[model samples]
Target: MVKFRYFPDMKDNNIRNFCIIAHIDHGKSTLADRLLEYTGTLQAFQMKEQILDDMDLERERGITIKSHPIQILYKADHKTTYTLNLIDTPGHVDFSYEVSRSLAACEGALLLVDASQGVEAQTVSNTYLALENDLAIIPVINKVDLPGAQVESVKHQLVDLTGCEEDDIILTSAKTGKGIPELLQAIITRIPPPERDFNKAARALIFDSVFDNYRGAIPYVRVFEGRIEPGQKMKSFATRHVYEITEVGKFLFKKIPTQELKAGDVGYIVAQIKNIRDLKVGDTITTLENEAKSPLKGYKEMKPMVFSGLYPVNSDDYEELRQSIEKLQLNDASLRYEPETSEALGFGFRCGFLGLLHLEIVQERLEREFDQNLITTIPNVEYHVTDRQGNLFIVDTPSKMPDMGDIEMIEEPYVKAEIITPPEFIGNLMTLTQEKRATYVNTHYLDPSKVQLIYEIPLSEIIYDFYDKLKTVSRGYASLDYEFIGYKPSKLVKMDILINNEPVDALSLIIHQDQAYYQGRRLVQKLRSLIPRHLFEVPIQAAIGNKVIARENVKALRKNVTAKCYGGDITRKRKLLEKQKEGKKRMKQVGRVQVPQEAFLAVLQLGDEK
Candidate 1:
């Protein structure tokens, strides 16, 4: 395979590569849209709302799914000289891996916070990550034009949280382009130029990547020091794999090939690389001869936090689902998986994800891209079990549950949660938290009316539809932030489902005993709706260590099929078979038809159902 590189002759001091980081719906995409317009990089007619978030799901969901880099010419001081590479990143916690990669690629970050919401959980988490990465932070208080926007108070919160000076906060609304010019000026003045030694061997950081049909895998990189050009050989400092660049391109609104790229420029390279697994985010790429003293520290790959199985509604579409997953993984490095064989569900994948949103995004993309319907099991977190013999096993799927006697101790991860809510809801919020196996930590009054409630909760509890429920109870008035706080010993059990004395792997779950009654009943109810009316009664049971807490039955389906296939209706039997296959495909075959992802999710809505 051949490789190519870019070596630009221009000075590096005039260019800037930065990213906008914010909480979900806090206007990161909006600000990016305005920046493109302000710089004339995009014409008014060419502009679409959230254009950088080009994915249909992303645009519709209004959250960036991946980091996108775009370069524009900024004319200041009578010179159209500076090349600004703006990376718009996902703001939700599930995409923190993408956020970290974007931060690593830039010398600075624009920390956009909503003026009305103040510093949200994601805002504080992302800001702290940026600061830890040693990037120069420019705090921008957005949404100033809104009626409830409290720009001044938000500035105070920014200072209090980040230690950034209150005067450093820039008030702006990306909607009307108010203060956008000053915000651009701040980018030029506050963010430093990329520091590099051109004489040294080339070294750049792979902060983002995408798959293109024309050019296999394109890794977006920041040339921190040195230069590169087409046909030059390079190697990943961490992976020790070498490749020659086939194409080097600058992201000018769209990725455009350039003959050369110099130190401090943010662009992408199409190498002899096909699989994205080789070019990891945060990995350092450098010239073969002059490698870094050591690969950039802290380059560990992201570990998936949630696991589930994805099977096709049509058994024959299994390969198509696999292909779709491969395509999706090309762009999403945070998604991990391996071919998994299930006795009941047939061929599928034991897929891993960063969180619930990550899982949902991948599933949606699979269905959209491959045009194949899928039957997915409820997502579960991995657990570490050590037997009395000191053997350790990481249990990702409930089907892999260890023998009851072999288990000695089980450890599960916990998280520190910070919830900001109105004072009036404090009592209900406390009650809700306590019910989720949460222990109160501390509470602070942000002002006279708003309060910050801190709790230490098991990561397992928050992993499953907890945020959605939390939001529901808080009436969208609460903001939650949490980080993994290591593992703690807890009373955990595998709640198994037996269909006619046979254990159904897809129906098992790892849950705390205290929650087994509520969760078990919920799961049983979900299964009752999910399992189609089949021949004979099928029992949906949630059992903890052989003890059944809840049971529901899906009665034998009457009138599921026509009694006769009439003349000219021969096609009807075939059609019915096709429809039955399609409907059954949606139902997971866990000894029988398991309804679908929607039904599994619906079980959580029993409270609303009441």
Candidate 2:
């Protein structure tokens, strides 16, 4: 057993630090609202649903993409007053990094499960993450008020997964405010306080942050072994940047100014630091006078898994788009973008994201928040290319692939996909995976009716429409979670789209050889429908190097003759028609076909969407 020495400046008994982890639409934010109301942190009249999810996009989508930490004062029936710091985390796998950071700052986690949905993919994913963090997990079944609750079945699942007693599971309906008081009491009595050493140097962990135009970058931190105040000077272990603290506060729905935040406390700090990049999440904070020997462990930075190009609809707004992305990146560190130019689309930025949802969120934010019309390219996974000379480099865009003569081999990313669904759907799901080149892994029965299927699949195959197909085959019951499993050598070819004999570099794609012919045919057929008729018949071709695998033609617009022909000579009318034909031929030779932006977008979804 291990023992902890309390920081001399603060006591641990009155504080409880914990976070709520759950699957998407699993009542996490709703439960947080009840906790705040039960503790009188916010009055019922002043409370809004999902108040912690401040982003408009999150509210619109009914999902939490970011984690927000808030402090509540709960007075128990035993006349014991406690300070509860609750961090609310997002449920989607795309935001797993945020969940991990939130777990790192807490002593315990509320393992919330939907009473109806029971255990989903993200539920298992987050529970394992919490276990890895060594957090004390409290199993709680939420939304018991729903008619389809299936309370007993969910309870059994929870008990079996957690290895906890049935009596330990708490049932609550966040919408109706039932069981809120008991939940508060459990948090204070069950969750342990942060451990600290009185003689050790001051240390704080920065778990999350937000950008403020007026206040700059405000970091939410958990004090591990020290106290921080408005006037204290500190240094970040990651950035090594030192600054004198300008303010210290705790978030109670909003920032509430506080005199000091000691060990076992969760609060925000304003260090007058304008640059958000300096406030790296997972970085340790120590006093400048006596810097800590090393930063906290497990501080790996998040790397983007998917990449795409974002260009302005109007080329003139390129600078505006660049500035908007810069401001957005200040708050979202996972977004990676740099300047890139395209032959077909002109200037844009190649942006990297965690997953498809992340890419959608960033694109939505850009269009809705920044009010700019934009065009996004097809998302691509990073590929590792090895040359004949044994030099390895990464290619994010298909058009950037090295020449075949110089390339030794191409390696594509693969993922270990975990899928859980009813056993009845297993047959169909297995068939779907085989079509996508999925390597079968072991399957286990979660229960009599539920099964967990594992497979190793190419990231490229799933990046586009595998999830949609899986859902269709499983009848919307299957849930998926995946992790990168490195790269393997594959027979991949670069497929380019050519319009009127000219290749559109922006429309290039990397695809497996087996599906190349079918996909290429489908792409050209879709393009032929989307591209408008030009002056001359325009040919749309999908090519692999010099070989054209699929081709379609967009018929030229017909020009009718309406000239006056005084019933005199048929020769005069023939000459007029010939002149018109010659004119059209000359125009076709001089005029270039312009492909609309939507045509490009349509090609991206050709295989995915109906």
Candidate 3:
């Protein structure tokens, strides 16, 4: 085992670092609020629901977008006060990286499950992640006060899933603050303290960070060995940029300055680094004087799994959109945007995201936070294309794909999807999966009423509207989680959209051969409804290379006319009608069909066919 410098002044037994993990809407944030009140960390007047969730977006959406860590002073049964660092994590699968980093910063985790909802897909996924980190998991059933809650049933499920005793599962109603004190006491007594090594160099793991206009980049770190204080010169292991720490503070809804953050403690460090890009999350910070021999493990650069193009509704906002995305990327490292132009949409950025939810959140933030009107293209999954020369290439956009003759094979990403639902929805769920080309893995019974189904499906099949359909078919009882397994060979084709026989590159898509026909027909049908009628009939077609497979027509508005009189009058009317016909032909050649913003978004929600 590697040894590190330990701080003799601070005792490791006094610190308890742990994070709370749960499914969305499982009262995880509510429980965090209750814990703060119970521990007297925040006064009753200062207490707010989801105190850790400070972002306006998070509050509005009723979810945590970023993980927050706070320090609380708790008095144990032995009459001794201990410092507990509680990190509140986002429950969404899109933010799983945040959860993983939070777990890596702690020695224990609070596995909070909703009593009413029982064990959900996210809860199970998070539990396994915690176990992988070797964290001591404390299973707690939340929202027991709700009328529909089945505490015993949930308790049995927890016991079976966690292999912990039924009696060990603590039940709490976050709204009423019941069982909070017991939960707090259990945290102090049951969770083991972090290990310390004072003899080695000072090292801290930077799990999360944010930009501060007044001070600069402030990184929230968990000190695993040694200590950090004001005036200490620290350098990031990954970036190698060094800066002197100006101040260290604990997050108490706001920043609260502390003397020093020692081993096993979590707090924020304000350095002179101005650019947020320099302060990388998941990087280790060690003293410049005696740097740690090795950085802490599990540091990885975040890569986006989904790619989409964001064009400004008004072309003038292109620069504004670019600047806005740059500022947003400071807060969200997962976001990747590069300047791109489309033939139909003009100037925009091709942005990459972690998942569909991530893509939506970024788009929503761009619109709401930056006040920019944007047009987003359909989200696409990264595909692997192998050429005839045995070279592999990643295709993120349809236009980037190589020629069919040059490409030896094409592979699309697949994920291991886990769905937890009521037994009644099994047949419907199966049908939905089968339609999406999902292969069965296995099924397990959580209890007499609930079932967990596993399947392997292509990532592209669900990227658009799978979750919405699942919730509809399952009657809102089903919850799902998925992780990318790998890429598999697929028979895929590029489906293109044409307006007036001219192919629109922005509207083209690379889809499976089996889905090409249906997708093509649906897109054309939707486009015909969105594109306004021109002077002449406009034909919208879906084509594969040179062959057209589906077509729809937007009929032109007719103009009322009256002609014919006497024999000489009829000849004059004929000449007039000929002139009108020539004019109409000229108008048809010059006039361009305008497709509205709704037309582009309409094709995104072609849900699973019933």
Candidate 4:
């Protein structure tokens, strides 16, 4: 009897799996489009720009929100056929967890650098992530045909950063379809195929998964040591629960059914996983009878750093919003939420996200895809609050914080931020970060022209206008990447906003003592601009416990009650004015200010206080 690693013919033309990594607008998606076109994976008419970015928001924003994996076939020299598995990853920092998950499933990566832009923060950060996974990285310089293409400068940076030879870097213009053949040739020649172990127990790594109403949860997997197919009894390495797989397939844009997904192949398995929670993204799937003892490495649970309250615009849509969020949770594993209510906002869920952009994407997706009208509160980061007598608890929302008198100390999450930009922008970036209370760490030069600055800054600072400020100061020359290091003790307090002497808990926030006054002033100022003039003066005050830090009022729209007494006596005018004042007082006592939708959104714009 003869045994084959993947397939009998696959040994002749091996399979190569790889993904592209770059900063935003660096042309990873364009390069992917060119590859798909060149390989004839799809007909010319069937293709569009960023075809892998399936979401409507991704297409409109020109950014990839998800990591899409697909398999393509390439025929070289009119004889040898090769299987190319390409996992196109997101470029934004908020989706770095998605990038890491995709990288772990692949054996190699194409480290893409934009010719004119050179090395940015995310490019460097992803390179280190690829290195940690021991992926074979091939440096590629893209957009070489652009008018401002400085191919030589970018090549030098790549050589310096990656330490690869100058000639090893492939130059390509994904827009014009130039040097694509050479790039594909390099993939088959330079990047080696996945190693195989046929005789061992079946083991496959689940890198991503999706929920199917009819078929249940299906996991996209990379087989390490075995073959998986329909009718095979498999158990989750993490859950130890057994189920029978009904189907197995590979991605060619769509699910193409295969007889079996063997070792060294990338495909999906339908174990009929009814419970979406059981289908973990990083779990290992193996045969039930002789299962692998150890779970796959490089898998970690992602904690949501940013928290916000998502409330329905209509109180009646609360149930629909909950269902939509639950459905989205099945697709996004990192999303965490629980039932939370506010006295002013009514019923809502306090949802957690990886970052600000992640929160934005989810909110947009829910509104667009699920047809749910939601009002997302300002984003907040998780905090560690230690009360007196050594009791500790997590406060993701300001309302969750204990009384100030009972609390010993509060710790805010801190991240080690890596920022890369032109040497000239270093001073400007330092000023911007300093305003956010960033602590200087160190600096290094990728080359003489590009500088990398490291700092330890509070995660809350970056969650707001830090990115916008960084870009403004640097004039679009800077890039940022950050990771949560740990929590550190800070002089933090819960600041509440009072509208007409009533505390609106939804507008409350936890802030450092030093920034409490400044932030409060900004909040009141923004709310004052957003709220419309009322029948009476409505005071908007920002207070810390009992002390008011800032106050802004929506002035009353003066009505001319005395105008009717145009030719009347002076005493008659005075009596009319007095009666009007008494009526205004009565209205103020019983009237409730109806805050507009934009007013709730004003919390997000408070960071623009500058």
Model 2 lDDT tens row, 523-603: 888888888897678889999888999999999887666457768879888988888889878877677889888777765
**lDDT of every model, 2 decimals:** 0.80, 0.85, 0.86, 0.87
Q: Mind giving the per-residue lDDT tens digits that candidate 3 earns over 1-610? A: 2122222243568888999999999988899898898888899899887788887888888898888888788777757788888998888887787788899999999999888899999988998999989999999999888999999999888988899998788989899999998898889878999887766688898888888778877888998898787888999989989899888867666677777777777888988778887876688999877678889998888778899999999998899998999888878767888888888899999999998889888989988889989999988999999999999999999989887778899999999999999999999999999989999999999998789999999999888889999999999999999987899999998888999877777888998889899889988988887899877888999988788999999997765433344456566777776777787788778878787888778668566343
Best by TM-score: 3
Model 2 / residue 338 / CA error / Å: 1.1
Clashing pairs in 2: none
Q: How far is 537's C-alpha from truth in model 1 (Å)?
A: 5.1
Q: What is the TM-score of each candidate against the true structure?
A: 0.88, 0.94, 0.95, 0.94
Cα displacement (angstroms), candidate 4, residue 236, comes to 1.9
The local distance difference test score of model 2 is 0.85
Tens digits of per-residue lDDT, candidate 1, 1-610, equal 4333343444657778789988889999999999999989999899989989888998889888888889878887766467788988888887776688789888899999999888877887888889888999999999999999987778777887778888788989999999899999999999988886777767788888888777777788888777777788888876688888877878877777787667778888878687788878888888765656666655767788888889876789888888888888888777898988776678888999888888888888887887878888767788889988999989888778787678899888788998888888898888778778898999887665467888999877787667877788889978888877788888888888765445667667787868778877876776676666774556777777668788888776545564566567578878876776666535434445544456544534544542
Model 2: CA > 4 A from native: 1-10, 560-589, 608-610
lDDT by residue for model 4 over 314-382, one digit each (tens)? 989999999999989877777889988988788999998988888888888898889998888878998
| Pairwise lDDT winner, candidates 2 and 3 | 3
Ranking by TM-score: 3, 4, 2, 1
